[model samples]
Target chain A: MPKLFRKVREIRNFLRSFRCSNDNSNSIGFVPTMGYLHKGHRELIRRSKLQNDLTVVSIYVNPLQFGPGEDYETYPRDLERDLTVCEEEGVDVVFAPTDDEMYPEKPTIKIEIPGLTDVLEGAYRPGHFSGVATVVLKLFNIIQPDRAYFGEKDFQQLKVVQRLVKDLSIPIEIVPVPTVREEDGLAASSRNTYLKEEERQAATVIYRSLLLAQKLFSSGTRNAKDIKEAVLRALLSEKLVSKVDYVEIVDEEFRIRDDQVMEGDRLLVALRVGKVRLIDNWRFGDEAV
Target chain B: MPKLFRKVREIRNFLRSFRCSNDNSNSIGFVPTMGYLHKGHRELIRRSKLQNDLTVVSIYVNPLQFGPGEDYETYPRDLERDLTVCEEEGVDVVFAPTDDEMYPEKPTIKIEIPGLTDVLEGAYRPGHFSGVATVVLKLFNIIQPDRAYFGEKDFQQLKVVQRLVKDLSIPIEIVPVPTVREEDGLAASSRNTYLKEEERQAATVIYRSLLLAQKLFSSGTRNAKDIKEAVLRALLSEKLVSKVDYVEIVDEEFRIRDDQVMEGDRLLVALRVGKVRLIDNWRFGDEAV
Candidate 1:
């Protein structure tokens, strides 16, 4: 059974004790999540376990990250099931702090990157990245992991964290794990549970468009605008995708590429399938999206 | 001889090596400054040395903290004299990175407190605290010291750092040393070197006013407005005190107090003596300011 900590202080003390005794290999690997574990989260846990001597998982549905009317209240959380998943995955510790524990006082410090933050997801969901950046930094400080793991599914978020760590000179390596998807290619997300049966099935179109963009890029289609247009067309073609929020081809740094798509570029898409917002992305060289 | 590190990566490696070897006593104390060593900085270093097994001092003239038309270009710096001061204070290591070394790339992530940041010195120097907060966080991440020392002279900055560390759950403790002053009662500062002989003589008014406020507060005068007015009057009485920036009485957290000055309250003042800007503060319970 994995030890469960609901208080920040308790978990910090527990982690410190573990850190002190585990001097032989202090490579602490951390995977921060918002609970409701799925195959995507398991993949991150597995990667952390393999790369580090100790693996710690944090499950907090950060209210700060969700904007007004953005499903914060409806976010899926099953502590029992999440604990079971952690134990099965051989997680060293499971930190599940409440809203109060995470934010004892109203947070005054805001972490943001200007140009990178004010576009794409940030453009649609204002102040969303600031919340993510702030909470991620707090988690990093609390865990003080040797290396932290983040899935590439949230491509912009991953870029934000990478830039934040690099710009701030935080002494931790951020390991990016490829997104895990269903057999039908729908990206694994707790929000997927909110999707009606038909909407869930239709959600595969999000990934399908990404795969199409990747395929086009692989087949000598170099223009970023053309790739984005093709992705937009594919996404809009789906009857269930009610709205195409954005379809962009960006380089590794999340900067929207105006010219040719390189080997390491990213194709990111976000859309609404029956009112459920979904996002997916794929790197150019990754095994088919 | 204290180890000098100009590169972030090299200093990080050297610090890590020292941290690994000196595991028994990991009480690393840090004092971060912008060079031009003074009695105030020396006081912080000495306190760090007295309290911790190892004391590390960083001297980087952070450009981010200075806004347009500020004194960043003219900021005084003397590395040789600073090195001698650190050596004299028994500093274990001195991390002094150049502008290029510290800011290898443009920084994107900024740390700032909302209400606390918009008043006092923050109001006078726009983006100053944000710059201060950002650099302090970066240095804190790099050093990862057990206890970090800050002087009470920059009282608002101390409060901001305290709030940041607490809000972020940064495990390191913040130790505040009292402001060091000259025999004439003027607060010590690097900018003091820029003062003309006459302006230097008149600079003592900044401290005298604080002492006057302290005397009044001790004599059962609690009205914040009254205390502020008296302090302002004392400052304006000095001919060389060209301008009075602000005089405020607030709690330890820097919230402006409308009522009486009680225990743990802070009375802060900032004024200009000719071209030189000076600041000073006194806690209610401190002896004679």
Candidate 2:
């Protein structure tokens, strides 16, 4: 069983002591999650466990990341089953802090990446990336991991985290794992659980739109407008998709690409199917940057 | 001569290699400065040297902390003499990056403590603490020290750093050294270099007012308004004193107090004599908390 921690001080003390011991491989790799463990989380955990001496996973459904009318209160959480998955994956430690433990006081601290986080998902969910950056930075400090893992599933989030570490000189290396998918190409997400069987089938259209952007890009379509329109058309084709939140084409740096789409640019999509929002992205060209 | 580093990657690598060596004392103490080492900085370095196995003094004038029309261009920089001070003080290393090195690009990451920062020195100098917090946090991560020292001369800066660390869980212990004063009781500062002969003499009133606050509190006065009025009167008595920015009394957490000031509560003041701005603070009662 992975060692469980609720308080920040106790785990810091533990990591310090662990560092002094000969058994400590001296490298801690972290994977932060919002629980309700799924295949995407497993891939992140598996990668961390492979690359580092010790792997620690954080299970936090951060309320700060959710906005008004968002599913923060109803975010799926089953700690017992999540712990089972961690134990199966041989995680070294698990930090599962209570709300009081994580935020003893109403937080006054805010971390923002101005231009990078103000578009796409950031545009849709104001203060969402700020909250994500704040909590992620806090976790990075608390864990003091040599390298941390983030899934490409949250592409904008991954970019935000990467830029955050780069801009702030955070010492941890961020390892980006590819988005895991089901047989029909639906991105594996904890939010996927919220979808009904029919809604789940409709959700695959999100990934299909991403692939459609890739297919268009591959077939001599360099114009972001042409790709975006095609992707949006595909999403709208799915009658159940209640809302097409955004179909954005941004370079690796989240610079909006409206006309010419170059290699390494990503097409990100967000759509709601039967009240469940699903988001996915695909890099332009053949290989991922 | 203390070893010098101008790059973040270089210092981080050095610290890592040093950590693995048996010769390392297994502890690092950091004192970040703006060069032109003064007695207050010397005291901070002295305390760091005494408490840890190694001491690092970073001598970079962070441009971010200076607002438009403020003292960024004119702030003191005498690296040759500053290095001499570090060598004499038995410092282990000096990480002094140039402006381009410290901020290669315009910073996007901002760390803000909203309610706490929007008052005191924060109010007078907008985006000041945000800049301070951003740079300090970046340096802290770059130099992963066991402990970092701050001077109470910049009382609000110290508090801001403390709150920043607490809020972000930065895993660094902020050790605040007492404000080192000159023979006339004025707080030691780099900005004092800008003061002319008569202006220098007038600045002593800032500290005198602090002492007066202590005396008034000791003699059974708890009213913050009365103490603030007395301090303001004393500051205004100096003919050369230009402006009284603020004379604030706040509890330990920077909750402003207008009525009753209790023990451990601090009286923070900011004033200008000539073109230079100076700030100082005093705890209401003796036996500091």
Candidate 3:
């Protein structure tokens, strides 16, 4: 069973002791999550376990990342289930802290990557990337892991984290695991629980639309406008998709591709299916044109 | 002779090797400076050497902290003198990277502490504290020092750095050393070089005004207004003081004290003598009142 730590100091103490006694345990791998663990989290955990001697998974639905009217209150959480998953996956430790514990008082410090944070999901949700960067940096400092895992599902988030580490000269290696998906096409996410039975079926459109764009790209549609238009049209075609938030084509750096979509450029989309917002992305190079 | 590393990667590599070879060298203390070492920096270096097994002194004038028309271009520099000081003081390593090295690209990542950064030095020098926090954090990550020393002469900067570490949960201890002064009471500063002959003499009024406030506090004066007024009066009365920027009373956490001044409250002042700006602070508890 993995040892659980609720307080920051206790975990530091535990890691210190663990380091002191285990000379052979030179590397530690960390996976930060927001609980309600699924195969996506399991993949991250597996990647971490394979790479390092000890693995720590933090289950925290960071309130900082949620904007005023967003899903801070209603974000799905299941600690018991998350803990069981960690135990079953042969994890070494788990850090699960309360809101008050994570934020003893109002946090004054903020971290932001300006241009990258001002587009796409960031444009839709103000202060979201800053909050994510702040909390991720905090967790990285607290855990001091040799390597940390972040899924490519949050392509923008992954890019922001990478920028934070590079700009700050942080020593940890950031490993981006492939996004895990259900047998159908919807991306594995804790928020998937919020979808109704039919909405869940509708949610598959997010991935299907990405495939549509990929098929178009593979068949010689390199103009970003055409690919984005095609993806947006497919997402809006789904009746249960209450609103289509954004359909954008961008390179690995999150720079929006306005005219042309080259190899490795990604088609990312976000839309709401009956009040639940789902997002998915497809890389251009994945399929030959 | 102390080892010199002009690159971030080299210093990090040196530290990694130092840590591996030295079993008892558990603590690494750091003092970050901007070259042209003075008594203030010497005191900080001394404190680090006394407390830790190894000492790393970084001397880089961060361009990010200087605003438009501020002293980024003309900031004092004497690498030969600084290296001699480090050598004489027995510093273990010196990390002094160039602008191109420290910031290879346009730094998009910005760190800000809202309330504290929106006042005083932060107010006058826009984006100053954010720049300071960003570079300081970058240095902390690169060096991974156990404790970092900062002088109280830069009271607001010291507070901002402390907040950065506390809020981010960076494992380094922020050691605050007392403000060092010249025989006549002017705070030791690299910017002092900017002051002309008479301007240097006039600069003493900054510390003297702090003493005036302390004398009043010692004489049972408890109103922040009275203290600020007295300090401001002293600063403005000096003929060479071209501009009196600010004279305000704030507590340790930087909350502005409007009415009553209590124990541990600080009287922080900033003013320009000639083309040079100087800042000084005095804590109330240091005196009987």
Candidate 4:
């Protein structure tokens, strides 16, 4: 069974004690998540376990990442179930800190990644990426893991982390895991539980639009405008998806790829299914030009 | 003699190899500076040598911290002299990377500490503190020193770093060494080299103003306005001094202390003598409030 830590102070001390122990060869893998564990989270933990001698998972629904009128208060969290899943998955440690513990003082330092952060979700929710970057940095400092795992479901976030680590010269490997999806093609999210019966089924449109864009790109449509238009059309076709937040076809770096869809370009879609917002993305094109 | 490493990759590897050595109890103390070593910098190195098993110093004039018209190009640098000083001080390693080594990619992330950073030097030079914070954090990550030394001569910078380490939970102790001054009370600074003979002699007014403020507060005067007015009079009395940039009384944290003078509150003064700018500060009142 994995040991659970509630306080940042305790967990930090525990990690430090282990670090100071003569075992210099031990490699720690970290998986940061907001609770309500599902099959997707399990895959991340399983990957961490396979790659490192010790695996640490942090489950804290960070309040800083949510803007005003966002679903921060309504975010799902179940510690008991999360602990059970961690134990069953053979996780080494689970560091879950309270909001007060995580943020003892209002963090004055705002980590703003200008061009990369200000698009897509950043446009829809201002100051969101900064919050994510700040908290993730704080967590990274505390854990000091050998290799940290982040799922590409949050494609923009993964890219931001990659840029931050490289730009700052942080000596840790950032391992990107492919997005984990449900059998129905809907990207598994804690918010997916927020959907009502009919809304749950309609949420698949978010994934469908991304897949459709990828299919278009695979079928020899190089223009980003056409791919994005096709994605918007498919998403809006679902009546239960009340709104299309964004349908962007950008290169790996999140810059707008309007001229042509080259290799490793991404097709991203975000939509509102009833009251719940869903997001999904897929990479298109080959490695070569 | 301390070994000199000019590449980020080589220095990081050297540090990591030392970190993994069987002597797990060894503590590293770091003092980061932009070259052109002086008495103030030597004091920081001396303190680091006394405290840790190994002491590392980084000498790189960060371009990111300088404004458009600022003196980045004219910044004094004598690596041979700097190496001699490091050897005299018994330094362990010197990490001196070029501009390209420090900033390979244009950093998109701006680490801005809003309320704390927007005043003082920040007001005079926009984006200066953000650049300082960013580079300092990068150096701290690269060194991973157990304790870091910072001189209180750059008082605002010391406070910002303290906040960054605390807020980010960086597990390194920040030791603030008292400001080293010349026999004439002029604060030791690299910019001091910019002053002509007459300007150098006249620049004592900056230090004099701070002393006068301390005298008034020490003599039982409590009004901030009175303290500031007296400081301004003293600074302007020197004919060679060109302009008074700022003469203000602030608390330890750099916030305006408008009311009664209290213990540990700082009186800060900045002025231009010929083409060179000088700054100095004096703490008023006893340690106890």
Candidate 5:
């Protein structure tokens, strides 16, 4: 690993300097995170290393993307531990910029996806994906990565990023990796650490609901409304799963499907376990019986 | 000009084909425009040719950026004349792609700017800048120009593009060339052709109001409200100027300014000269004065 000690200005300066440098073979892969390193993040970075010549990981908990009363401050962060993980993962550079550094002045401009952001997670978290799109785009530019990796745990987010890249013509490839899960099939997430002992056990309902939908789909249940009801019932039965935000069965492009799920459709589910929201998804035809 | 005849498969295919061609010395400067070519567009291409080793001009009337009942269909187009202009301007490539070629599938994603876009033209034509930002970004990615030229006639749009490049970290340099105007102080625009002979004369008020603000500012008038009122009165007095949309003095960054005028601030004004809407602006302490 090539260690680079940098502040915000230093990172930007380094990027400018590298643009003119004759190191053409140096391919940089980037993984941007909101601090609080988790196993899911590690998998993203690990995959990045295997593909690129150098890897850069950015940890920034962006405030713009957070709506009023959302967890902007108490979102959980540990830079010291995160640095340790990046070092172990063979990360060439670790960018941990301050809020002021990331946003030198008030952001007068923002990027938004219209219809896509109005559904699924977007509906629940209003300007959430817009915030995500803005920060991720900023990181993409600052890091200037050849390839960026995103996990499918945030399926809607992956879709938003895909649209952003396509619409903006951003010159980077977005690689969507499989969602990492815990032993009981609960999707691994940084927020998962927020769950209490009992809440942790209840969090498994998210995956359980997805599994229920998958089983039904395999058993010739093609009606989206019926499958959605079955999944909702499974989540409603869990004691610790306080609220179900949404249970959607949509096509690959995230459009709501009613009757039949074609070959590449996905069944996505999001539920709240003790105030912590967890999301998980699985493709219809790809799951084993 | 090495003209190659092949329809592009996708944005990626176009970029790959351009990159594979072994011509490293030539730097490409791009000027993107709607189909109807005018003297203003020709000027942009001329400047592009002088500044870059190769010039590329793309004629795409992007529909995603136009709102319903906003003259998207009635927008003027003359491909043969546009080609003649390109050939005259020494343009190395002319990317005249069909709508289906550009958007093989419907775009699920869009680009939008918040507070900045919510006011002025954005208020009048909702989702206008979002459409502009989306299409401009796409063009930027497809062309991959070293420098992109935009006229200052669309002052808000120039600001939005600057913000997009800054926020997104796009590598291309955004160069804002001066607005091209006619002999009668009317800013040159393709839409000018839509105006009747009398409406064309009345359109001069758009620039006249901007000039009035400049005169007031230069004659030791420091109050923003007084300057705006003068400009508004000037536009309302014109028989052909149907409606005065807005007349305000803002700081360089498009922020509303109420106090004494700074040296580098701008006075942006817009109005409807008959059925055609026109906008113009002047910067304090600039050579255009």
Candidate 6:
């Protein structure tokens, strides 16, 4: 493991120097996160190590993405613990930039997906994807990674980032890793730590609902409305799941589905367990559904 | 003049190639334009050539920016004429890409500046700047120019592009050139050709209002509202000026101004002459206003 300093200017200068270095055979892969490293992040770093000569991991809890009432300040953060995990995972560089370093000046530009953003998380929290798209694009430019990894737990965010890269013709290739789940099938997230013991137990219904829907889809239940209804019923059964934001069966491009589970289509579900919102999705292939 | 043939596999391929080439030198200056080259474009090319080692001019009339009822099909296009002018200007590369070439896949990504966009041209035609930002960002990546030039003729657009570059940290310097105008003070544009002889003569009010605002600001007119009112009155006087879209004195960042002209403040004016819309602006400085 190569230990790199943790400063934005230093990291940028280092990248510039590396570009001019004599070593022309090394390729760098980057995985950007918002600290509180988990198994999902470790998996991303592990894949980066396996594929590249160097791996860079960035941890920034971007304030721009959080709404007025959202958890910007209260969001989980632990640099020391994150660094240890990164070291264990063989990360070559850990770029943890300060807020000022990331945004020297106020950002006036915004990236927005109109119709797509007006639904799901975007509907719940307006301007969320715009913030995600802006920050992710900024990171991609600064890192100039040959490849970057994003977990599919934030399926909508992953889709938005993919669209941004495709639309803007960003040079970096985005590799979306599968959503890492707990043993109980709940999608692993940094926010999952916010759940109380009983709330944590009740959070299982989110995954349970998704699993039930998946099972239904596989067992000759192809109607999207029925699956959505079943998932809603399962989530409502859990007292801790205060709100069912949306349970959608969408096509690969995130377009809402009708009656059938076409091969390669995805079923995405989002639910608010206490104060924490968790999202997960599973793709249906011909063999499975 | 170095003419290079670009066989772009994708926009990313183009960006990567440019990045590798740019790292070895100061890189080229870029001027992106919709085809239908006129003397105004030549002026931009001249400025680009003077400022950088190489000049790259892109001729792409992005379809995304055009509204449904807007003159997308009837929009002026003359690639052969544009090529002749570019060749005469000693442009290093002329990136005349097909719509298919520019958007290989359907574009799902959109970039928008809300408050700023909700007014001005964005107010007139919904989602215009989103399309402009998306295409401009795509071109910025494809060309990877050290400095990109945008005419102040479209003041709102210039501000939006500047914001995009700054907000995204897109490793390119944005250089806003002065609006090139005809002898009658009409701002030159590719769309200028759409005007009939009478309408063309009447189009002078677009710049006339801007000039009036500049004159007032220079003559110790410190109040923004007063200057705006003066410009609006001047534009409204012209019978051929069908609609006065907006006339405002704003700060450099496009924020609405109240009182006193800051040294680096800007005065923007926009109006419709017959069916064509035109915009212009002037910076408040010793030599400018």
Better model by TM-score, 1 or 2?
1
lDDT of 4 by residue, A1-289 (tens): 7898888778877776576565466788999999899888888888999998889999999888999999999999999999899999999899999878888888877887888888899889898988898888899999999899988888899999998898788888999988788888887789999999999988877777777776777788888888888889888899998998988878767788889898798887778999888888888852210
Residue A152 in model 6: lDDT:
82
Candidate 1 vs 3: which has more DockQ? 3
Compute the TM-score of each model's chain A versus the native chain A and list the values.
Answer: 0.96, 0.96, 0.97, 0.96, 0.94, 0.94
Candidate 6 lDDT at B68 equals: 88
Write one digit per residue (lDDT tens) for candidate 3, span A167-252: 88898999998889898867899999999999999888888888888889888988888888888888889899889889998876
Give per-model TM-scores: 0.94, 0.94, 0.96, 0.96, 0.85, 0.90
> All predictions: root-mean-square deviation over Cα?
2.2, 2.6, 2.1, 2.4, 3.8, 3.1
Q: Regarding TM-score, does 2 or 4 come out ahead?
A: 4
* Residues A142-201, model 2: lDDT tens digits: 898989999998998998888878778888899999999898989889999999999998
lDDT of each: 0.87, 0.87, 0.87, 0.86, 0.79, 0.79
- The most accurate candidate by DockQ is 4
What is the C-alpha lDDT profile of model 4 across B158-249, one tens digit per residue?
A: 88899999888888999998888888878899999998888889987777777778778778899999999998988899998888888877
Off by over 4 Å in 6: A1-9, A17-26, A238-242, A285-289, B1-7, B10-23, B196-209, B236-239, B258-263, B284-289
Ranking 1 against 5 by lDDT, winner? 1
Ranking of candidates on TM-score, top first: 4, 3, 1, 2, 6, 5
**Against the hidden true structure, what lDDT does model 5 obtain?**
0.79
The count of backbone overlaps in candidate 5 is: 0
Model 5, residue A20: what's the lDDT? 33
lDDT of 5 at B112: 61
Candidate that beats the other on TM-score, 3 or 6, i.e. the better one: 3
- What are the per-residue Cα lDDT tens digits for candidate 6 across A215-234? 88778888888888988898
Across B1-289, the per-residue lDDT of candidate 3 in tens digits comes to 7899988888887776565444424779999998899999999999999999899999999999899998888999999999999999999999999898888986788777887998988889889988888899889998989899999999999999988887877889999999988998888899999988888988888878888999999889998888889888988899999998899888767899999899899888888898888888889978421
Q: Please provide the root mean square deviation of candidate 2 (C-alpha atoms, Å).
A: 2.6
What's the lDDT of the predicted structure labeled candidate 2? Answer: 0.87
